[model samples]
Target: MTQDTLNILHLGLGSFHRAHQAMYLNRLIEAGETGWQLAGGNLRPDMADTIAALERQHGEYTLETVTPAGERSYERIRSIRRIVPWDAELAGLIALGAEPSTRILSFTVTEAGYYLDERNELDLRYADLASDLAGTSRSTIYGALAVILAERRRRNAGPVTLLSCDNLRANGERFRHGFLAFLRQRGESELLHWVEANTTSPCSMVDRITPRPTPDVAERVKAATGWDDGAAVMGERFTQWVIEDRFCNGRPAWEEVGAEMVASVHPYEEAKIRILNASHSCIAWAGTLVGYRYIHEGALDPEIRRMAHDYVTDDVIPCLTPSPLDLSAYRDTVLDRFSNPHIRDTNQRVAADGFAKIPGFIAPTIRERLADGHGANSVALLPALFFAFLERWHRGELPFEYQDQGMDPDLAHGFFHAADPLLAFCQDLTLWGPLAGDRQLAHAIFGAYARVQHFLGRSPA
Candidate 1:
């Protein structure tokens, strides 16, 4: 561990970061790069145990990549230099952010972290933001970043680039909104202005299927290395990151390490949100309804596989900007990636956090289809299935576990129950934005919801 290595701090230590960003940094290191090393902070107390285990192993872990060729495991991933528990070490977390060596602040805190209002500005109503404004020790990654940026401004230090690896569209913009809202609320107008003028939050599109490793995979890694490591991550062989060329401080030669740096990440982000994410939600909701447990099993089923493919190719892809890449090739790759048996991604895991995922991933596409004067025949079917799934999931009738992150269960129930004709649910502008006001589109979606519900029918509990 050399001091000269560039210090990059990652906020969330989830499976996605381990498989995606950490692996990318490792690739750079293996290629003889010296300017990049990673440090991590786990935001929650329960995460401290995992952080401790990774530190005990010298911040080293194995990555098992599953592809059609075979399952290959890489044993030595040395890019991660340290893991700091955020709750136990708040001062250390703030200090790491103020360090001049730290140029990039990356996060995978998921959509919930943004905490936006109806206008999509940072939600001041959030309890954590309220606490941060009161000059309390900020706990969430966004809150911590706000405090760090305020400190960095006082020191006249150089600006830092913030990167959001979450699934939300224009995720960088959302993060900026949340961070700026916190700064402004704290009466730090000058600091807020400085960040607006100096910092860059580049939009990006990232795709990879990294399932939380099964106990068996963890055991295998330990048996292979004669070391007990619990933080190992297993993922599908496929991975892609397309980022807009925007940064305040200098960035890693990520392009040199197979990341695509583009003039605008909009097209790539839109494509992924529509084609990949939308299809994933469809499979997740519908597969669970049909009693399939794993993503690979759902992909294997003749009916479910066709529905997933058609939902993407026939409906979603057409709504996206035309790309030079072969659409069929992309679709084939997505299917193959989902079918990787070595990754046991549960339908339930994919279905988690529907409130955040749907509006960004599926509903936006639905709006696009409607705006283009396309009927809801195919596109509307997805949310219909989703709404149905929500109804069942809330009632505790579905076998899959639902993770709501404090979103009101009654509100979810109301959204499904009140949309009696099913298409009426599309009329809830609060849920679908302004597009929900379009009567023709709303009616079409309602019809589709009705059709799916009719098909499912009332079975014995």
Candidate 2:
């Protein structure tokens, strides 16, 4: 594929995008596919270093994959045709989206990056969301897309699909909902009509354990490739992308390159989100409190792994049972993958966006279990661990920084100061969702909190 043949505009050019989606596209290109070269951009400056490094390398990078047996391999990825640098204005990204050839706008802007409420509305409380309300292109996916899609509408660019590659349940539909809500907030009925008419949002489920790059990654890349790669990414050997076979413009024959193009991504999505993703965070938060730096260490610990295993086998599996996938095997595979020593997946990385992770990944099992009149004890343990981790942060005992897009420091501090922090944390509607006000749910969390405290050999707070 030539650079001029770019047909995919990817937003949020970060680690996961580089390792997962871009790698899939590169595989297709290697097999003689055409007309889908990727153009990457970031709305926020958080990855300025990555953007600059990719630009310096002319959009080529290395991918290091480590297997469960500690086997490491490297691949040179050249799927990205160009990267729109982070400037004060988002004009370049808007123009890329407006190009008629750019039939797809895919993104890996994390779960929290969506900035949506429980109602799936655009969250304007964010500064960029507020600024974008005034019609200026800036940061945040909503603001950025509001500007880009408006330009596409004005230019009458051919219909394009907004493929969301985040760890979001109903990701494509969620993005579509947030986009329409943002447009409505902008009060652009004509543009809104254009977007509604021209866009397709197909839900998908993406899985990979691509942790943040460590120094050893660069060293391995240099030794293996005879050159240094600053923007290298390291991921697990196993990867999957189950996309709903619905598209507006057109989609690559991704299935030809190991992606699953299915009629409904619902079953696959539910299993992955509730099982793999939720258990990942459970280990991460629990691992952090136990002074473990990496997820594998926690996965190795008997207490930690038991919490995750029970959470999956006891709670998540029953809720998603009698399905096509083998829930037991999937549960075991996820735990085994989490225990991969070579990956060195950091607790901080997995535990960063707990506020978003809870609603998207953990809470569904709880909600389903509660709705069925079954106790959600196993699932309740996750948030209990997170709240305990938050307490450590509150007391400055946490060795690493805790970054949460939706966390309110004042509200979080109140948890530590409350007469019963576990009950207070359990009652936070934003985290526990529909079960926030349920006393039974609070009671379950209290029991989970006691388990976590017992694991840590600490007195109950």
Candidate 3:
């Protein structure tokens, strides 16, 4: 293979990429496809340990899978050609993107990583945005992306595709919108024009239940393969990637590896978001309130599992009708995956980002239910559980450190201190998105909140 084969540069080198995208790319290579190699790195220093471990292993790692019926399997993934070192100034990242051979830059940065505000525009008020505006490199996704685009423009790098693999709806469009606004904020009209003409952002829907790796994964790998792997990651056997058929440059033979390249990813996107992502968060929050540590535990619990099923059946499925996949089967499959006891999916991991999740995962469904004048009982349960969880965080009662990029501790603390805590919670415009001002939403939330309270009264949390 020629040097040009190593062309895809991926951001956010987390476990999900190893088990999902990189794995798909590896499959293409195995199928005799050439001229495509995965180069990856984290934008921030937070995951330096994993990167360092990858360096020791020469960018190869083990992926362990636990089936629904307790079968375990392992495989070595060798698709990532290099780990681009983390640099505070993002010079290395910019260099990677500026290379002529780099045709597609993909990312798995979390939902909150993109500094898009309520209107899905670049949020100028975000502290990192201010820092990036002040010329600090790599402060946020916008910052790193700005530098990369500018360098690519200067180098006259041909058209490139920025593929978003995040869970947010219409993620690619949102990235382009926020990125153009960011360039406008920087007053780089030339770069902005270059970006518009030279780049394409394709929305994608990616799925796999990859939990944070605990010691058990490594132990299992060692016992099975007799190789001590420091960078091993694990996931459920199920994986899917549905991509919108939009790319400025060519792409890997991903379809050969089970990825669906289609006319539009909207139906798949909406189904996964409303059903899998939303109900996952529901089980996470509800499980936390009831002292469950793992997702399967909650999925097995009668009340917690019932809440998730009702949330999907009563409102989410209806909200996402007329889709490509059978909604009912998809819902059942999601529960089956969640109930995979071997996965050990933690409530804390799923519940950590409540502040970032409400708008995309929960609020949209609630807004639709209220707008249609339908009973929002199942949908409203999400925010009600969030309110309870936040109160626990405020009281220092949570078992783990709740990590929310968008929530402020002082402001969160003030929620319970306020005379009308429910009103205080509902008034945060950023949290609920467009539905923040809808009095109907606030009323529905309160009604649901009362039910959660009354249920807790009997359940003994």
Best by the lDDT measure? 3
In model 1, what are the clashing residue pairs, if there are any?
Answer: 6-35, 423-446
When sorted by TM-score, best at the front, the candidate numbers are 3, 2, 1
Q: Model 1: per-residue lDDT, tens digit, 63-113?
A: 877775666665467788888766643666677877777888888887767
Error of 1 at 426 (Å): 2.6
Question: What digit string (tens of lDDT, one per residue) describes model 3 on residues 410-436?
Answer: 778888999999888898777877777
Residue range 220-259, candidate 2, lDDT tens digits = 9999998878799999999999999888888889999999
* Residue 441 lDDT, candidate 3, scale 0-100: 77
| Prediction 2 global C-alpha lDDT | 0.86
lDDT of each: 0.76, 0.86, 0.87
Q: TM-score for model 2?
A: 0.96
- Top TM-score hit: 3
Give the Å shift of residue 378 in candidate 3. Answer: 1.3
TM per candidate comes to 0.92, 0.96, 0.97
Clashing residue pair totals per candidate (backbone < 3 A): 2, 0, 1
Q: How do the candidates rank by lDDT, highest first? A: 3, 2, 1
Model 2 spans > 4 angstroms off = 1-6, 458-461
